[model samples]
Every structure is written in structure tokens, then in C-alpha cells.
Target chain A: MQQVIQANLKDNDNIEPVFSHFETQLNGERSSAWHQKRKAALEELKSLTYPTTKNEEWKYTNIAKVLANDYAFNAPSDLTKEEISKFSLSELEAHKLVFVNGIFREEFSDYSSEKGLHILSLKAAYQAHADLIEAHFSEIASTKEEPFTALSTAFAFNGVFILAEKSAVASKPIFILNITDTSDYPVIAQPRNLVIARENSEVTVIEDFVSVGGKPAFLNYVSEFKVEQSAKVDHYKLQNKGDNNFYIGTTQVHQSDKSNYNNTVATLGGGLIRNNLNILLDGEYCEAFMNGLYMLKDKDHVDNHTMVDHLKPNSYSNEMYKGIMDGHSTGVFNGKIYVRQYAQKTNAFQENKNILLSENATVDTKPQLEIWADDVKCSHGATTGALDEEPLFYLRSRGIGEDKARALLMNAFAEDVISRIKSETFKSHIETLISNRLENR
Target chain B: MLEIKNLHASVEDKKILNGISLKVNAGEVHAIMGPNGSGKSTLASVLAGKEDFEVEEGEALYNGQDLLDMSPEDRAREGIFLAFQYPVEIPGVSNTNFLKTAINEIRKYKGEEPLDAVAFLKKMKEKMKLVNIDQSLMSRSLNEGFSGGEKKRNEIFHMAMLEPKLAILDETDSGLDIDALRIVANGVNALKSPDNATIVVTHYQRLLDYIVPDFVHVLYKGRIVKSGTKELALELEDKGYDWIKKEVEEGVI
Candidate 1:
């Protein structure tokens, strides 16, 4: 064990620039209490090695290609509305926070503030909403266990901050648009976010990662949420980047008593993408729902790691993730459900289903459940198969063409996960994107 | 409309259809009665171009073209329909969507324009009445969670929409109740014309009572041993299959 840890530490030499960038190049509030935390976080990040397939959590994904690139931190750029307008779901009147690179863009954002909802940039929120920022920022989502979260914490610059007041409900959805236009050299971005829904509050927040100009860029993002008692939060992460982009994102949620945390993650772009979704049901009677879909083609690699931690009694969690892999692409899903000893009568279910549409396409899925509570009802299932032949032959036996038949079956398989979303607008938005992806495949 | 000569086929080296010869012109209804493991369904599956069966040696001519050379979809477009014994359940594709796509695809293969949604639904409503299918079932996923009777009725509904030149009912009456059986037979009788033919494969003569056949052939051990009029069905029904089995064993036709 000692030798393994030592060897892993040795691999950190490849990520030397990451540490040096935080120490010498990072330009944020230098004198604030959070800056000292960032400095300590950078030093902590230096002791660990880069994650690789040897690690149990990353066995099916290889980070050699992403780590081998010469990635450097880039300064923020002012983005025009026309340049980023293609990605905005302009039909909805909601709270908007637009970010380019890692800096918040305020000119292209607006929301009605009549419903006791607070929105601000993380850097500005540190000075304005100091109590809320200090209470929840980095409080729930830890960087100790995850190397990507450690990197994002060490180099945190700019992101969004949202807080829904006690018993308050947002009039509409909240859109956090994170756009990257790496028209020049390859760049790396690190953004940190904090979201808090106070007691009995209800809110919907959508985070979009869009890449313009097909540039080669890397985005490492960490967003943390603290849902208070009886609160309801619907969180979405939509990753649509350029073909050469690399993205590693993590969204961590901490729920209070009787609170609800619902998450839907859709990854439709990027060459190498990994998303870590961790929901910690810390209070009794809390509920969590996770639904995800990843459509990969053309040698792209996507890995989704999800965990629903039931720490208290009477908590319930349901997770379902579906993937469609075509061409020579690869997909990986590792879902874990952990029930603590005190979490009696907890009901947790996790399922991951994948379809490999081509001979070269591949999928690796591991659905795991670790329960210390004897009274818990936990079930985990994983299915990986080629498209069913009976249904395909049945479709082609009619006059439908082979390509259309395959696409139809693939879409149907995807809908098993997509249909679970409760929001109609988001459902149709994801439906259209997934429809185009499946048809193109 | 269809002719097969010396059709010998197998699945994984197990020969099923052995030297089967048959001919049927348009407007004729032929009933094939057989015992179990007699390659009755194999003949139907081979006609539909299912990939599992290997045609060892045979010549099946449909409309002066080689039926075996075309794909399943191409054969359906060329006016060949098989009402499957066990219709597959597709949980996401609606029956209406499948039928519309099938009708439009077959139309495209015939060098004709695809019908708009209104025209397509109009035709669908017309055929729905012919098959006694409800609009609610048409909107649901195709045959998913449907009863056996509903699936058979759905197959006939598909046949009504396609209007094939040769419609092969492979035990379409296997799992249907008396009412479902009547509805299916009524739909077949309504869709029949002088330009289309029907071949009914069955193990019992009960279905033959409703959809009367012009000729009845007894298929024993992959070979047709007897051919007679509709009275042959009644005789076989009364005597049971052992009489035919004993005659075939003794080499007496």
C-alpha cells in the first residue's frame, strides 16, 4: 500500500504546470480568507498524483491523452451576445449568468429579483454575501477524494453564486451559461460555483457548457449545492463543446431533512469528457433522483461517475443512466449507492444501460451498492448489449430501412432514461439534441 | 402470384423444409395443414426472408423475380406480407408511426410520392375500421403490453395497410379467442381481391371453418402428401393427424 501511494505521487510530475500556475499565475482576491484556503488547497493538490486507469474509480477511462497536452491557463475574454447567442435557450424568461473562460459576463445576463432570489458572481459574492459564501463554499464538495475538484479549488477564479431565500420559489428557471471560445492556443479553465436553497425553497438551475469555433480547450469545473430543510432543487448540466475539447466537471449536492435534489446530466459533445455527480443525502427523509444520457460517436470518450450517499434514515434515491455508443466511440458508467449504518429503511436504486451500435464501439458499466444498514432496500443493475435483434428484424421486416430502424431503436433505448425528466421544456430541449445525435450516428 | 419448387432449407444444419414444392396464383386461398415439426412455419419464414433460416436449395419466384434475392423490406415493398405468429413488441415506436413509415417507405419503393400526415391518417382510420383496431391502441407503442389477440389483430391491421399481393398468415389464429379469430378472418376476407392471394398455415382445421380455403393440402414431414378441396379439411379434422402420419410412414399416398 505504501509503495502504491508513493508511485501515484510520482505521477504528479506530469501535472507540474498545474501547481505552478496556481502559485504564480492565478490572479484573484489575494488577501481574502478564501485566498489562504486556495493556497492551502494548492499545496494539498501537489502531494497527490494524476488519476489514471490504475485507480479503481477511473479503471475504464484513460487520462494519458488529456494529461500529455501542454495546457496553460488563459485570461478571460469579453464575449458578444451574437457570438454566444446560438447556445442560449432564448425562449425562456429566467435568471441568467453568462461566463466566458472563467470570468462572469454580466452584460448578457438578467433576472427578476422580486422573489427573494439572490444571484451574483463568486468573486463579487465573496464581498457582498460573505456569510452565505463562507458557509457553503467548499463546505460540502470536498477536494480531498477527487483530484479534479482539487484542481478546480486550487485555481478557482470566477463562477456563479445563487441563493434562494427561506420558503421562496423562483418565478422561472435559472440559466448558467459557461461558454469557451478558444480561437487561439489551447487553454484550461477552472470555475467554482456555490448554490444554496434555503428552507422550503424551490428552484430550477441549468448549467450549459458550450464551446465555440471547435477550439482545443480544457474546462475543470466544480459546483456545490446545499439544500436546506424541505427545499426542492432541480439541477441540470448540459455539456456541448467542440470536437477537440476536454471537460472534467463535478456537481456535489448536500441535502437537509425532507429536501429533494433532482439532477439530469446530458453529455453530447467533447472529445474526452468525464462528469462526477455526487449527491449526499445527509438529513432524514431526503430524496434524490439522477437521470443521465450520453450519446458518443467518432472516437469520443465519455465517462459518468455517480454516487448517491444515504447518510440518514428514511432517505430515498433513484439513479438511471443510459448511453448509446456508435462508430468507434466509447462510453463508461460507474454508479455507486452507499447506505450508512444509521440510514435505516432507505430505498436506493441505480441502473445503467448501454447499447453498442457498431462492432468497434464499446461500453463499460459498473453499478454498485455498498450498504451498511441492514434494513435498507437497495438494488443496482447494469445492462450492456448490442441493439436487440428481434426488434431490429421486426422493424426491417416492415418497409423501414436498416439505418432508420437502428436509429429508431437507439432513440427508444435513450427515451427510457430521458422520459423520466419532469420538466417539459428541458425534456424537449434534450430530446431534440439527442434526436439529432442519434440520427447522425 | 407465388411459386416454389424443391425448396429445401435448414437452421444450424437441422433441415426443416425438405423439397417443398407449391404453386399459387392470385385470388386463391390455400390452407396448409400439418402436425408439429413439419416445417410449416419454416416455409412462411423463408418466404419473408428471415436471416436465421438458410435456404439450402430452392427457387421461389414472385412476380417473375427471385424472392430470395431481395431483403425483407424490399420483399415487403414488392407486395409480400407475413402476419407473424408472434409479433415483436416495440416499446417506444407507436403503431401509428410504424404503419405510416411502412406505407410511405413502400410507396417510395414504388416510385410514388409520400403521403402527408392527414392523408396517411385518413388511410389509417379506414384500415383501422377494417381490422377493428382502436385509435388508443394505435397511439401506444407497437404491440407492447398487448394481449395475444391484440397482436394478431395488429398483424392483420398491418396487412390491411400494406395490401400485399401475397399475404401469408403463419398461424395467425394460434392464440386468438373466438371473437379475435372472427375479426382476423373478417379482415382477411375484406382485404382479399382478385390480385392478391392468401396462404394459411395451421395445425388445426378450426380456423379453416371461418376463412374457407379453395384447396387444403396436408404437409407431413416437410413434404405435401395430399391435396384436395375444402372437404379435405373437414375429413382431416374428423380423422385426426395419425391417419395421415401412418399413411406417410407406409409410403401410401
Candidate 2:
């Protein structure tokens, strides 16, 4: 395990080729504002260095090994719906947008028609609704400090773009299905997504990341959500990729007055995965709920970093994340709650709990709350330990085997976050995934 | 149905039960009364095969099978149930789901088909009446935020569901009120049949009033110093355990 310290993606030979491929996919939008944003993002990415363990933010998660591979940029796949039938949620009736190797495939995508609701690929939206794209694109997901966010912005030609117009309620959810086919060569897919829920509007988005091939694949995803005044948005990210894939994603949310935003990300499997979820409570009386569940085994590693910033008065936010690790896996949770001086009467709560089933499995959790407002209330806690011996024996004394008892306990640990899911279909789907993973491990 | 010969056990290398022998037959109820730290609960735990307790030298034969050699789950699947003194709270695991998993696993062990949802619900409905447990409590997290009386009642409900051949009630009346004790004792009495047996291990003789025992044994320093009929329980209750302790100390029992 050598720490090569791959400080800058700018020095890698793969960057130029990947940028050139991204430019070719732009389809002659060189004069557009989006192209200029990409150019500016590339320049910003060169100045930013890849994070190392020495950096406090990445102290526990060392991603140098995942980034050491030489990924191919020219990855092209023509996978059909039948090939990816295994990953489909049959009960989920929503608008389906499919992407392969970060390239939108219109033939495999279908959308539901609804008045005042606009859904398109980022590239298509730049062409049809350039004004909207120009206004929201790159506004919240800044690339100045984060190299991965910069990389995603530099190659943001293909992804999902959704806009819910004023007072428009989406009839159903919008499912963005991203699949990676690395059977040909090791590849990388950087997809940028933007979601806007206008004033008094509501929308739900499900991002399902899956991979088909065994070769090494990397998915760098960045999504921005703008929840306007009195609007509601529910976001779910299901990361169930192959064993040979790596994932790093950033979800940045901006909230307005009286808005509500709820997010749940379940990372069941992957070689290495990292998630950065940040929500800004910039308006008064906003509400945010963040829930996450990650179960890892067999050398899998996952790191989740979440931040909630309350800048206005009378806002509330609550976050709870739980993890189950076994078989030499690693899990990290870093949550920060910041209440500004003016954010009086704010209430924020954060908790992270983990269960390590094996001696080799490990977890590092840190919950930090910084409050400048004297009238605000904030609390944070983290706990990491083995399953309770009393409960384990209680289940076994009633005829459950040792393995089944452990699995039941693990499932019970995950239900805290799973119960927060509002969609029954999605909740059952997640429960199945979590239980299957727990049993197999 | 259950036989124990010179049972000796210890936890963490500290001796608890030392050289004790007892036998319980089908259709019989045996009550063991003892003072605090007199190895009453240790005997029940050892018979139930709690892993923390190591059997130093003993043989527990349940239906002529070596119960001490079997795992706790196997012992349970083989119709041996121990009602714990303190049931642990398992958050997020509903009482119904926990019972279902336990029942199905026991059924699979006995080469029987697992119960379906409809059958399970019906059985649960019937068993709830045995202990007067509410339907809402079954759907909530197991034993979480439950009152002392409610937890005890739920234990009886679980016992009714499992229907074990040998039921070991360990301090089942410790935290129960008078009404709760009556309901729980009635549940146990209703579940008793000619094909099964019961071992009531208690510190106080009050529980025996409702679910009367056929035989009473006084355990002093891990060995039965006295054995008699139901009248022995009344004597111990009226006279207290100091006389029994004095007899054991003076070798006059």
C-alpha cells in the first residue's frame, strides 16, 4: 500500500484525453455559456490538488489507491434495457432516464408528460432552455476548492436536468438510472445533474447507480438541488455498483424560505465509495432531513461527509446515518452542523451509529456542531460498537441461529434510516437490498 | 421429562451452582425457593445453555438427550424455554417480527413447515388473549419503553406462542404487580398440559399462590437442602429463609 500521493489530476496523462473526448461530445456548443463554464472549471481544477490523508477532511479515507489506476476516457456502450433488467425496480412507476458511460441514450429513456414540468439531459437542456441552464448551472456546486467537483464540472455534458415550474406538482417521481459498462476497458463516467423545484412546487428524484462490467470503472457525480420558497423535494441516491467500480459524488442543496428538502443515500456495495452531502438553510423557517445507511463488507470502503449550515432564523435540520461493516471493511462518517449568529431559534440534531460485526471491520465517526447563535439549540452524537450481547442472546434463545440473529440485528440497525423513506415501494426495495447484503455477508 | 445430576456451573471462573441434582417429570410443577445469591437463577440459566455459564461438571438430560452439550438455540428448538428475569430491549425489531423469525426458525429445526403470515397472525391473536397483551404492543419495538408489568406479560405471551415442553420461569414475578402476577400466572397455568413440565425458580413464595406447585425444594448454597409438597412453600413463606439458612449452616436439615 504505497502512498503515491497523486496530488493533482492535472499531471495525469488521462486528463487531456478525457477533456478532448468531453469536447467532442459537446457537439459544437463551443460558443455557449455552458462550454465557457466548463473551460473555467478546467482551469480551476488545475489549481486544485487531489486530497490526501494528511488533509484533515480526508484523514481516514485514503483515495490514492482508487485514483492510481489509468482509466480510459473513450468508453462507449450500447447496452439495452434487457441487459440491465436485473437492476430495475419493477414497482417504481416514474420517469426513467437512462445513461451509459455518462452518455444519455434517448432510445432507452421515457418521460411522463406533465404541465409545467421540464425534464431533459443537461446537454439537451443547454440547447433548448439555455437561459434556465445559464442561470442555475455551476451556481451552487462550486469547483474552486473540490477537485472531484471540478472534474465533474469539466465533463458535465451529459446528465439529468429537471425543473419543476412554479406551483407544479410532479405526478410521479423522476428516476435517473446511470449504468456503467466497463467490459471493454477501464472507464470513468462523470455526470452532472441539476434539479430546481420552483416556488410551491414539489418533486422527487431517485438516482440509481449500477454497473454491468467487471473491469475497473469510476463514477464521479455532482448534483445541485435548488428548493425554492414553500417547495418540497425528496432525493434518493442508490449506489449499488459492481465490485470493480469506484464512486465519488457530491450533492449540494440550496434552500429557500419555508422549503423542505429530504435526502437518503443507501450505499450497499462498491469497491470504494465517497459521498459529500451539504445543505444550506439560507432562508427562514426552512427544514432539511438527511438520512443515510451504508452496509459494507469484503474490503469495501465508504466515507460520508455531510454538512448543514443554518444561516437564517427559525430553521430546523436533523440527520441520522447508520453503518454496518464486516469482513475488513471501513466506514467513515463526518457530520457538521453550523448555526450562524443571525440564525436564532434554530434547531439542529445529528447522530451517527455504526456496528462492526468482525474484528477486522472498522469505523471512524465524528459529529461536530458549531453554533454562533446564542438562542439556537444544537446536539450531535456518534457511537461505534459491536452488537449488544444481550439482544443477540435473546434472539438466539428463541431459536434463531447465530448468523440469522446477527443479520436480524443488522437489519434492525438499518431500519432507523430506512423507515424515514416516504415511498413504500422504494423502502421495500431498499430493505430487500439491505437484507440480502446482510445475509450474504 | 427433565433430569439434572450433580449439576455444577460457573461464570468467568467464579463458581455459582455447585453439585446440585433435581428431576422433573411431565405433568408435574416443581418450585425451587432460595435466598439471594443462593444459585437459583444460575440453575435456570445453566439448564437453558447460556454460553456465559460454563458447566464445570454436570449432566442435564432433557427427554434423555444431553441438553448441556447442545447450543442454546438448539436447546430452544428442542422445546426448552427459559423466561429471562430481564428481557433486553431490541429497538427497531418489532415484537411480531421477532416472534415470527423465532417460530419459523424453530419450526425449520424440527423439520416442520414454516408458518405463513395468516397462520402467524391467527396464532398471535389467540396467544395475545392468554396474556392480555395489546395488539399495538406487538407491532411496536420489542420491549422498548415497555413498563415492568407489560414486559412480564409479553414474556408470558411469548411462552404461550412457543409452547415448550419444559418451561423454566426465572424470577418471573420480581417486578410484576399483584394484578400482573395473576394474569401472568394464569397464562402459564393455562399453557400447562400433561405432556409438559415446569420449573419455577423464585426468591419469594408469592408467585406459587396463583400457579400452585406440586413439589417444593429449598435450595441453600447451590444444593437442595429440603424437598416437600406444596406445604413446604407455605412454610418457607411464613417462616422466611433464615431458618433454612440456619439449618444448612448447622447441618440440621
Candidate 3:
């Protein structure tokens, strides 16, 4: 493991420049309290090493090719209006914040909301709301345990920050679009986000990572969320980077007393993608739901690692992740539920299911539960299988051809997961995308 | 029309259908009553081209075509339908969608244009009435959470929608109550036409009371031991299979 880490560091062309750029930005006068925290975080990041397959959490996902690539780091590039328009979501009246190459693009953002909500770029938020930013930035994400979280903090330049004050309800969702256009050379971009929802607040956030041009690029992002007592928040992360892009993202969330947090991560396009989602249920009566749907084709690879920690008593968490792998693609799902000693009466359930279309397609799923409390109700299960032949025959016998029947069954398998999306338009859009993928096959 | 000559099938080298022979013309409903382990379901599965059962020596003819040579989907396209003894539950596929795909697939086989959404719904509504299936059930997943009687009714509903030339009901009455049995039988009886035939495979005589068969055959072990009219079903129900076993032992079957 140490040899792999040393080799990755020796071939590190993508991340050094970004670290230097962040250092250059910090040379100016620093008034925010988070500045000191950022300095400490960067020092902590420099001492840690990147993770490898030898690590238990990353056993099934290999990041050797990703660390070997030489990528440009956080270079400023002008984006046209046409390119930014491509990131618009259909049928959503949202406050859009666009980031180009991980730097906040103010000219293309709209932050006008009638509700008492603040959605600002991270740089601007750090300057404007230093106290709130200092209190929660990188609070939930542990730099010691995760190498990617440490790296993200070491080069935190610009990202989106959302704040919902006490008793405030943000009727419209806030959309964060991270666009990468690296046509000149391979580049790396680190986008770090922070979300804080105070007591009795309700909000929904959508974070989209997109690679605009068909260029070889890498995106490493970390998002930290803090949900206060009795608050409700729904978060969605959509990673549809270009086929030549590699992405490693970490989402860390902390839930308080009687709070509810729901998150959905969708990975549709990427050469090699790894997503780590961590939720800490720090208070009693807190409920968290983490759901994910990944569809891969060609030679793409997608890996999802999720952990839900039940720290207090009487908390509940449910997670379901489904993957459909076709062509020569591969997918991995590792979900763990942990019930601490004090977390009595914790009800946690996790299920992972995958469907392989081709004989060469592969999936590795491990659903685990570690319960210290005897009274906790916890269960986890994982299954990997081909399409059911009986259902295929039932459809074919109806006079549907074999191809169409297979497509229908495949679509139904994906639709079961897609229907869990709360937004109807989002659900339908995903349904259309899944249908197209199945039909094309 | 369908014909099976010297039909012998086995699974894992264990012979199930040993030289079984049967024939049925269109516009006739033939009932195959048998004791347990009589290879009744095996015959149905073999006719539908299930891959597990190996046909050691047999020829299944459907409309003068070699049925065994066709794939299951091809056999289905050739107007061969089998209402499964236990309809497989597909958790996320709607019944209406499944039926529409089947209908269009058969249409494609016949070189016909696919039905538009409006026309398909119109036809589905008509068939739903014939089978006494609720409209709500059509929108749910196929046979998911359905009761035994509902599954049988769904089979009849599918048979009505597909309108195959030959239909095989493999123990459709196994788990149904008296009222459900009557409803399912009535649905099948209503779908009878001169262009299509029905094969009702069952172990009991109660189902025949509703939809009386033109011919009844008793299968013992791997082959049919007796063939007669509706009176034969009554006699078998009265005397039971012990009499048939005794007759076979005495060389009087």
C-alpha cells in the first residue's frame, strides 16, 4: 500500500499546480476565521497519502490509472454562453450557480430567492459569512480517514455554499453546476462545497458535475453538509462527466436531533468514477435515506462507497443502491451501517442489487452491518444476477419480440430505482435517459 | 392443430415423458387429467420449449411445423400459448405494458403494424372485461402480490389478449377456490372459438364441471392410460387413482 501511494506521488502532475494556485490565493490578507482552519487543513492534507486497493473501504475500486495521469490544475479558461446553457435542467426554476474549471463564475449565476436563504460562491461566502463558514466548512468530512477529503481541503479554491437559517424554508432548489473544459491538456479541478441548514429549516440542493468538452480531465470534489436540530434537507449529486474524465468525490453529512436528510447520487458517465458518501446521525430521532443509481456501458467503471453511522438512540437509516452494467463495464457497491454503543433502538437497513447485461460485465457488492447495541434492528443484503428468463418469456409470449422484452425488463429494473426521485420532472428525465440507454442496446 | 408423436423427454437423464402421444385439432378443448408425477407439467413445459427438459426422442408438430426446433419466443409467435401453472411474478413490469409488448411482438411476427397507444388501450379494456380483471390490476406489476385466483384470472386475461391457436393451461385450477375456479373457467370458456383450441391439464374433476371438455384423458406415470368423455373425469374422481394403478397391475388398463 505504501509503495502504491509513493508511486502515485512520484507521478503526480495533476494536483501540484492546484495546490500552488491555492497557496497563491492565500498570500493576500486573511480576515476570515476559516483561513486559519484552511491552513491547518492543508498541513494535515500534505502529510496524508492517497488511498489504494489495500484499504478496506476501497478494496474493489482501483485508482492506479487516475493517479498516474498528468493533468493541468485549476487553470482559468473562458466558457461561452452556449457551453453554459448546456447545463440547464429542464422544467426546474432553480437558482443556478455555475463553476468553470472549479472556479466560481459569477456572471452566469442567479442567486435571487424570495425565501430567507443564502446561496453564494464559496470564496464570496468565506468573505461575507466568515463565522458560519468557519464553523462548518470541512466539519463533517474527516481528513484523517479519507485521502480524497484531505486533498480537497488542501486545494479548496472555489465551490458553492448554501445556508438556510432557522425556521426558513427554501421553496426552490439551489443548483450547483461544476463544468470542466480541458481541451488544451489533461487538467484536474477540486470543487469543495459546504451546506448548513439550521433548526426547523427545509431546503433542497442539486449539485451537477459536468465535463463540457471531450477532453481528458480529472475532477476531485468534496461536499460537507450540516443539518441542525429538526431540520430537513434533500441533496442530490449528479456526476455525468465526459467519457474521458475521471472523478473521485466525497460527500459527508451530519444530522442533528429530529432532523431528516435524504441524498441521491447518480453516476451515468465517466471513465473511472468513485463516490464516497458518509452520513453521521449524531442525534436521536434522526432519519436518513441514501439512494443511488448507476448505469454504465462500454468500458466505464463506477464505484460507490457509502457509510451511515448511528451515534445516538432511536435513529433510523435506510439505503438502497442499484446498478445496471452493460457492455464490458464494471461496478462496485460497498455500503456499511454502523450502530454505536449508545445507539440503542437504531433501525437501519441496506440493500444493493445489480443486473449484468453481458457475460463480461462485472459487479461487486458488499452490504455490511456493525452493531454494538443489542436492541438495534439492522440488516443488509446484496444480490447480483442476470435478467429473469421467466419474465422475458412472459413478455415474449405476449407477442413482444425478445429484444423489446429484454429492454422492457431492463427498463423496469432501472425504473424501480429511478421512481424514488422526489422530483417528478427529474424522475421522468432519468426515466427517458434510462429508456434511451436500454433501447440503444 | 397440434400433434405429439412418441414424445419422450428427460431432465438430468431421468425420463419423465416416456413415449407420450397426443393429437388435438382446432375448435376442441382436450383435458388431460392425471395423478401426481404423471409428467403433465413436463409435457406443457416441453411444448413451450423450456430449455431444461431434453427431448430424447419426439416430434411436436404445430400447424405442420416442427415445434421443437423453434425457440420459445418463436413458438409463441407461432400462436402457441401456455398459461403457467404458477405465473412468474415480475415486480416492476406493469401488466398492461407486458401485454402490449406481447401483442406487438406477435403482430411483428405476422408482418403487421404495431398498435398505437389509443388502439392498444381500447383492446386491453375489452379483454379486461372478458376476464373480469380490474383496471387497477393492469397498471400494477405483473402478477406481483396477486392471489392464487387472481393469477389464474390473469392467465386467462393474457390468453384472451393473445388469442393463440392452441392454449395450454397447466394446473390453472390448482390453488383456486370454487368461485375463482368458476370465474377462470368462464373466462376460458368465453374465449373458445373455431380458430383456437384449449388444453386444460388438471388433476381434479371439479374444473370440468364449469368448462366441460370434449375429451378427457387420464395419465398414469408417463403415458395416458385412459381416454373418454366427461363421464371419465367423473369416474376417475369417484374411484380415484388406486383403481387405475390396480388396473395397470392387472393388465386391464
Against the unseen true structure, what C-alpha lDDT does each candidate score? 0.84, 0.88, 0.83
Q: Cα miss at B227, model 3 (Å)?
A: 2.2
Give the TM-scores of the predictions, in the order they appear.
Answer: 0.93, 0.95, 0.94
Docking model 2 quality class? medium
Q: Where does model 1 exceed 4 Å of error?
A: A1-29, A76-79, A112-114
**lDDT score, candidate 1, position B132:** 90
Q: What is the descending DockQ order?
A: 2, 1, 3
* CA RMSD per model (angstroms): 4.5, 3.4, 3.6
lDDT of 3: 0.83
lDDT of 2 by residue, A98-173 (tens): 8888778788888854898999988878877899888888898889888899888887888988999999999889
By TM-score, the best candidate is 2
Ranking by lDDT: 2, 1, 3
Q: Give candidate 2's TM-score.
A: 0.95
Candidate 3 ranges beyond 4 A from true positions? A1-18, A26-31, A76-79, A212-214, B249-253
Screening candidate 1 with a backbone cut-off below 3 angstroms (N, C-alpha, C), the clashing residue pairs are: none
Q: What value does the lDDT take at residue B188 in candidate 2? A: 95
